[model samples]
Target: MKFSIERGALLRAVARAQSVVERRNTIPILANVLIEAEGDEVHFRATDLDIEVVDKAPAKVERAGATTVNAVTFHEIVRKLPDGALVNLTDDGASGRLSVEAGRSHFALATLPRQDFPVMANAEYSANFAAPAPVLRRLFDKSKFAISTEETRYYLNGVYMHVAEANSGRVLRCVATDGHRLARIDAGLPDGAETMPGVIVPRKAVNELRKLLEDDDMEIAVSVSETKIRFATPEITLTSKVIDGTFPDYTRVIPTNNQKRLEVDASDFAKAVDRVATVSSERSRAVKLQLDEDRLILSVNAPDAGNAEEELVVAYSDEKLEIGFNAKYLLEIASQVDRENAVFLFNSSGDPTLMREGSDDSAVYVVMPMRV
Candidate 1:
């Protein structure tokens, strides 16, 4: 197989492919990317058994054939090549090596038979829809931070994407929780997505998908089935198996009756929590929030490390309440608020507290309280 592609285009495609390739591989072919040259475009495909990524770049295909080479090595070589230089890749079926040439640099990488590459089986999607890149980015970025890393409860290790009934009617919702905190974000439902089945997108897949959402004007085509989910664009395609377990019933944990409302500037609140928590023990980086009338005081106490406190004025009219929460969780949750003010609703020190943008119910967060 032989192809000539621009250095920039080749590097971008190979970089994405290499990321999908596992560094430690039990199978030889799985560690390599399948490079196929044909029909004026070259395709680079890589997989780690569970997730597969295919990147296409325009190229001059002089020979129509396919081969596999170490994804990381190919990416490194292309990345170091001079920018704007044309890269040529050639493989003669019997040489057992793929030749990479660019300007004054040349290298030959060991090759694997493309026939051994495992392509994920295609699924009959139950729902297919198109969503703007920005919309999809917000849904995943906001909720992904809360995805649980615990392996035993495998279902909680991904963001749950499904259709839900919001106050304004049907909307697309993404929810993620690790028991300590939860993020739930909603976007307007796209056409033809009404019958979409809820799917738990794995953490790795969520991160890989982020690379595709950088273009604000791009529209992503999403396909979902019972077992697989696929996101595709004009030049790249990402597919992964959905988690096999059912996510916990999260609605039960979102506080509905929390009456105490405290509206505070999110940036200031996050910075205050960060500063005071510096004195807390590493094991328990907890910050206590004291609320009364229009005043809120954040303090952290650690017997061995000393203590720190910060006070801020907020809009609070309900009865006084004191609650403790992990400083990291508070910082992450607070940063998600794009608006100036973040509203916190509290029921008691023992119950989970709820937070959201000033008056926007579209994106909400629930954080469990800890003992001070």
Candidate 2:
């Protein structure tokens, strides 16, 4: 393929495609993005068999053809090209190498047959819907921190996205839990989305989709089937195979009748959790929360190291309660509440506790407590 594309445009397109390509690959073609030029546009497609991303940009096409080159080498060459220069990509169809020329920089990279690229077969999506970028972004951002990394429980490694009944009628939801804690979020349901199938999107796909939902007002077109799901913006389309297993019954883990309430500033709680956890052992970061009347003292004690304590004034009228929870877990969940206060609902020192943003029910969370 022969095409003359601007340096900036080429860099942006290649960078996006290459970021999806891992550093190491068993298959040679999997490490390269197929570059095709026709008419006035250049298309770049990259895939790892399970996940495929295609990006397109405007280019000056001299010859409508296609070729493949190492994604990393092509990206590095384009990145080093002088600013504002024009880049020309040419393949003679016989040399088996693609030549990249831009100003004083030039590269000749080995090419692979475009036919070797594995593209996902088109599917008849059972459901197709659109959501505002901000809405989709909120669903992932608030829950991603809690995604499980346990490979055995593959279903817990991704956010569970589906339709649910909320106080305000039906709403779209995203829930993720590692059994220790869970993050459940809800947003207004979009049109034509009530019948959408519940999909346990793999962790990697959620991260890739985040990059496309940065613009708050941009609308994303989402297509779903039993085994694969697709999320697309105006310029890019990302397709991936969904996890085949069923997610655990996460609702049973979220507490419902916790009565002891503690309300404290979210930032203050997070800072205290961070400081106290530093003194505890890495394997057992149990921070003891000593609450009495309106005074709350958070402390962590490790035999080998030292102890740390931070006191904060809260709005708790309950009797004295001492509870221990994983410091890392507390810190992570506390950071998610983007408000002045975080309300904790506790049953006892050992029972699972619930947390929320002040009195808001839009987004709720549950954290299992640890024994001191």
Candidate 3:
């Protein structure tokens, strides 16, 4: 295969594909990216058995052929090349090496037969829909932080994406939880997505997919089946197997009766939590929140380390309430509230607390309290 592509275009395409290739692979071919040159474009494909990503870039093709080469090595070489230099990739099919040439730099990388690369079979999608990039970005970005890392409860290791009824109407939702905290975000459902099957998008896939949603105006075509899901842009496509498990019904965990409301500046609250948490022991970084008519005091006490206390004026009118929570959880949830004020509803010190941005119910968070 032989082709010439601009360095910027080559690097971007290869970087996207190579991220799916793990550093260590049991199968040699799995560690390489399949490079195919044809017509006026070149395709870079990489997979790690469970997930696959393919990216295409415009190129001047000299020969129509395909080969596989170490994804990491090729990416590094292209990354170091001069910004506007044109890159030439050539493989003779018998030399067992791929030649990369750019300006004054040249290198030969060992190649594997393209026929050995495993490509996932095409799936029959039950639902296909188009969503604005910003909408999809908000859904995943807000909830992914709570995705579980525990492997035993595999179902909890990803964001649960599905269609559900919200107060306004039917909405697309993404929910993630790690037992201690949960994030629930909703967006208006797109047309033709009413029958979309709920899928647990694995954590790795969720992170990689975020990279494609940076362009707010871009439209993403999403396809989903019972066992697999695919997200496609104009030049890239990502496919992955859905987690084989059922997500727990999270409605019961979200408090609907809590009436104690405390509104505070989200940024200030997060910074206060961070300062107080500095004196907390690693094992139990708990912060106690004391609320009065319109005052809130955050305090942390660690026998071995020290004690910290900070007071902030807030909007609270209910009966005085004192609650304890994991400082880290509070900080994370607070940061998600991009708006100026974060509204918190509390039932008691022992029950889970609910938080939202100002008056927005579309994006809500639930955090379990810890005994201080």
Candidate 4:
């Protein structure tokens, strides 16, 4: 196999594919990327058993063929090469090695047989739809922060994407929770997505899909089946197996009739929480919010450390209420509010609190309270 590609283009393609390759692999071929050179493009395919990514880049083909090489080594070599330099790759197929050559640098990396690379099988999708990059980006970006890192509850370790009935009509939604906090975001459903089945997109796949959504003008083609989910563009495709377990019904946790209301500047609130949290106990990092009339005071008290407090003039007309929450959770929830004001609804100090951006119901967040 032989092909010549520009350094910048080659690096971009290889970087995308290699990110899917696991650093530690029991199977030798699973650590390598399969490179296939065709008429005018070269394809780089890499997988870590659960997720697969294929990136295509335009290249000048000297001979159309395929080979496999260590993904990390190839990516490192390409990244260190001089920008704009022409990179040539070649493999005789029998030597069990792939040659990478740039200006004056030459390296031969041990190769695995291309046939040994495990390519994910093609899935029969139950729903296929196209969504603008920005729309999909908002859905995932807003909710991914709440994805559970706990491995035992595998179902909670990803963002749940599905179609649901909304006040305006049917909408596409993404929900993620780690028990302590939850994020739910909704977007207008795309045509032909009505039949889409809800799928829990694993955290790793959600991260890989972020690269494809960077281009605001790109339209992402999404395909979903019972067991797998795929996202594709003109030059790249990402596929992953959906989590086997069912996600908890997040709706039951979202507060419904919280009467007390408090509206505060999102930036100011986050800064206050962060500052007070510095003096909080490292183990708990609890911050308390004391609210009455139109005043909100945030305080953190740690016997081992010192205590700190900050007051913010907010818009709260309800009766007095004091609630304690994890400082880290409050910061995360506040950051998701794009608008100037973050509205917080509270039923009591013991119940979960709901927050939203200004008056927008499209994106809502729920945080479980903690004892100070």
Listed in order, each prediction's TM-score against the native is: 0.99, 0.97, 0.99, 0.99
TM-score of 4: 0.99
Stretch of 10 with least lDDT, candidate 4: 277-286
lDDT by residue (77-196, candidate 1, tens digit) is 888899899998999999999999988898999998888989899899999999999999999999999999999889999999999999999999999999999999999999989999
List the global CA lDDT of all models: 0.94, 0.88, 0.95, 0.94
Q: Per-residue lDDT of 66-172 in model 2, one digit per residue for the tens?
A: 98889988898888888999988899999999998887777888999998887789987888999899999989999988899999888898998888888899999
Q: Residue-wise lDDT of candidate 3 within 271-370, one digit each (tens)?
A: 9999999986684588999999999999999988899999999999999888999888898899899799999999999999999999999999999999
Provide the lDDT at 336 for model 4: 89
Deviating ranges (above 4 Å) for candidate 3: 281-284
Candidate 4 Cα errors over 4 Å, as ranges: 281-283
The residue-level lDDT of candidate 2 at 253 comes to 85
- In model 1, the Cα lDDT at residue 306 comes to 97
